[model samples]
Target: MSGPVDAELARVVRDHAGRLAASLVHLVGDFSAAEDLVQEAIEAAVRTWPVEGIPERPDAWLYTVARRRGLDVLRREKRHREKLTGVSWPTEPEPDDRLRLIFTCCHPALPRAAQVALTLRVVCGLTTAQIAKALVVRESAVARRITRAKQKISDAAIPYRIPGPDELPARLDEVLTVIYLLFNEGYLSSGGDRAQSRDLTDDAEFLAALLHRLMPTEPEVAGLLSLIRLHRARAAARFDENDEIVQLQRQDRSLWDHAAIAEAGRSIARAASYRRPGPYQLQAAIAACHAEAPSWEDTDWTQIAVLYDMLVHLAASPVTALHRAIALRYVQGPAEALAAVDELESSLAEYHLWHATRAELLRELGRRDDAQQADARALALTANPAERSLLRERLNWT
Candidate 1:
């Protein structure tokens, strides 16, 4: 492929693959087959785009290829054609294609782990490795969960549409998990060379907003949307002019969008009025503490730590524990936080942030050599370019 065509094709695929896959699944009536059709569409682009030049409407072009291929596959299978006889090629995009796909993937027939893994793969365009990292599980486990979930969908004939109102609550948590992880990937990107991808965050926020509109009384939806907006409000201050990671303590508060923060505050207040606090609301409350702070030193660590404690009681996980340890550092001191972080080594040893947090605490305790070694482990474990750069600077390797 020529350089320009290759670059453009990559961008198109990165930005639209999830939506394209969602549409194809709707047309094909099979999750696994839709994914294969998407791959075939990409392969077709690889073969033709360089020769023909990238299409003026690359996403549309890919969708057209995938749709035609899906029809061909159904025709070849013969018996399946009867099942989809009423389906026709859509003249315009469905506004909720991705959301419907997420709901389908999160059907209660599937296990919670499978629901999360499959939705992250097909609805959020996350790779198995990325999903594994997000879930703190093995990559092989994530792949198997995705495969089994797809098979279960096919066997059970799960309809590729949003659930009716009564069924929505049953599947809401899994859908929210997928969207939260999607936003996290965008906020600090796990797989790509770039530090962050605004496109992923924008997609996540769009989905959350759609969910909020669909379930206006759902506090967790409001909480998730508020959490995302709070982070986005400070996005401009996350990196320096050279695009190096800027620690939150050192970021220029003037760069933050105060109006956006205010809007998110109202969202949190709205969520609280529901009087049904959940993990997401607690997490958003914690983020609100950070976003509302006048400076890092003025951060309400006591309140943040209390919120984390509530979160742990509601939904404990290794990642949550690690975050709580950071808050503990600010609340109690390095000694106490180190003990908490140390207890998580067995559970989160493979997680880069675990080592990174340990390094911070070790540095604070005057264990310079141990701190350097922990930072080295973090550097080795992570593929994220920005994180690797930050770790290198910490180790004085830059």
Candidate 2:
């Protein structure tokens, strides 16, 4: 392939492969089978595109080809008849292939990890490397996990259609979690020194916005929208003029996007109007506490502490608990916060955030030497240059 042709093929593959795979999984009723079929289709495309040029509806073409290839494999393996009993393919293509696929991959029958990995791979178009990085696992580990997930999808006889309203509420959490993780991975670039992780943020926004549009009355959808929009408002300020990391307290608030902040407030208010609060809403509320504060001193650490307290009940994650500790120190004073931190020290021993928070709390309590040691420990756990740089700078403050 020539340089331009290869580049074009790569672009098309990157852009549409995941969506195609999702559609195929929906059609074929097996995530693993769908991945194999999609890869086979892309191989065909690589050969065809170099000769016949690119097609107009490459994504649809991919979906069509992958589905056919999947059927062929099943037929050759003599499982087509049994698989045919499981699902009835439509004579005509559905209008919302991607949405149908999303619902299928997020089916309540699948394990949470399988749902997340499949969604990140097929819906978000992330490579195994990127997905592994996002999940903080090795690439080979992610590959093996994905392979097994697909096999389980086939063996467990999972359906390939959107669920009824009764199943929607229960399945919605996994979907939202996948969307949030995708956004965060993009925002932080997960495990990388790359200048930026594209599409991770964009795909997240697109998925969140699509959900908001599809379920206009769903408060949780609004909560997720608010969470992503508000967090992204400061994405610009997270890095400095030289692309180094800047602490949230030190970030130039002036550089934060007012428009994104406004949108977040709108979503948060919309979700609040529903009278049923959720994790995203509570987290967005905490973010709002930070965004609305005129200065670090003016920050509503007290309210943030309250919000985190609520979040602990809603989400029950150690990360949230650690965050709450930081806010508690600011509100009830360092001693109470240190107590809270110590309670979580064992749970968060390996998390960089824990050490960073521990160091800050120790410094607040006038234990400079211990605080410095904690900061160094925290820095040691970091792989992100921006975060590492920020932590190192904090160490020099001693």
Best by TM-score: 2
CA error at residue 30 for candidate 2, angstroms? 5.8
Residue 337 of model 2, lDDT score: 85
The candidate maximizing lDDT is 1
Shift in Å, residue 255, candidate 1: 1.4
* Model 1 quality (TM-score): 0.71
Q: Which parts of model 1 are misplaced by more than 4 Å?
A: 1-99, 108-152, 161-170, 190-192, 195-198
lDDT for model 1, please: 0.78
